[model samples]
Target: MFVILVYDTAVERNPKVLKTCRKYLHWTQRSHFQGELSTAQYRALMAALDGVIDPEHDSIVAYTTRSPDLVESTTLGLPLGGPGEIL
Candidate 1:
């Protein structure tokens, strides 16, 4: 599976959230990540994040597809973080 994960959390919690996401996905930009993961990996990622975020104040979003080819992205300026643009 391919997953794109985005998160917004309090400043103090950023490190934990970012670390958790990086274990399973490629960081793409500020608060953004993407790449392939198995179903188990996906579930594990969520579980790890569950412990890091405050549900009432933080937001994490994940979009999944059967394959990476199913998604198309365009970056308009310099890449802000992560492994730079894939292309």
Candidate 2:
């Protein structure tokens, strides 16, 4: 499946978070990332993130699909359920 993990944190701390994400995903843009993985990889990514993220400030939204639904869903005015919406 394909996954788009959207995240937000302090500009200074973003690099660390991004680095961790990059270890598991492909960087598509400055703040956006995409990747294809099995359920195990997805769970591993989430587990790593849970230990590293600070919920008081930082937020991570991991959306998964079999295709590029992230961009399509946004353009189609779909509701993204997470900490915040991208559109």
Query: TM-score: which candidate is best?
Result: 1
Compute each candidate's TM-score over C-alphas: 0.89, 0.70
Q: Give the clashing residue pairs of candidate 2, or none.
A: none
lDDT tens digits, residue span 5-84, model 1: 99989898999998899899988888888989999999999999999999999999999999988888887877546455
Model 1: clashing residue pairs?
none
lDDT of 2 by residue, 1-87 (tens): 899888877676677777788888976555667788888998998898887778888888988887655456343343333334222
Deviation of model 1 at 79, angstroms: 3.6
For candidate 2, give the lDDT of residue 81: 35
What is the C-alpha local distance difference test score of each model? 0.88, 0.74
lDDT of 2 at 49: 80
In terms of lDDT, model 1 sits at: 0.88
Q: Give candidate 2's whole-model lDDT.
A: 0.74
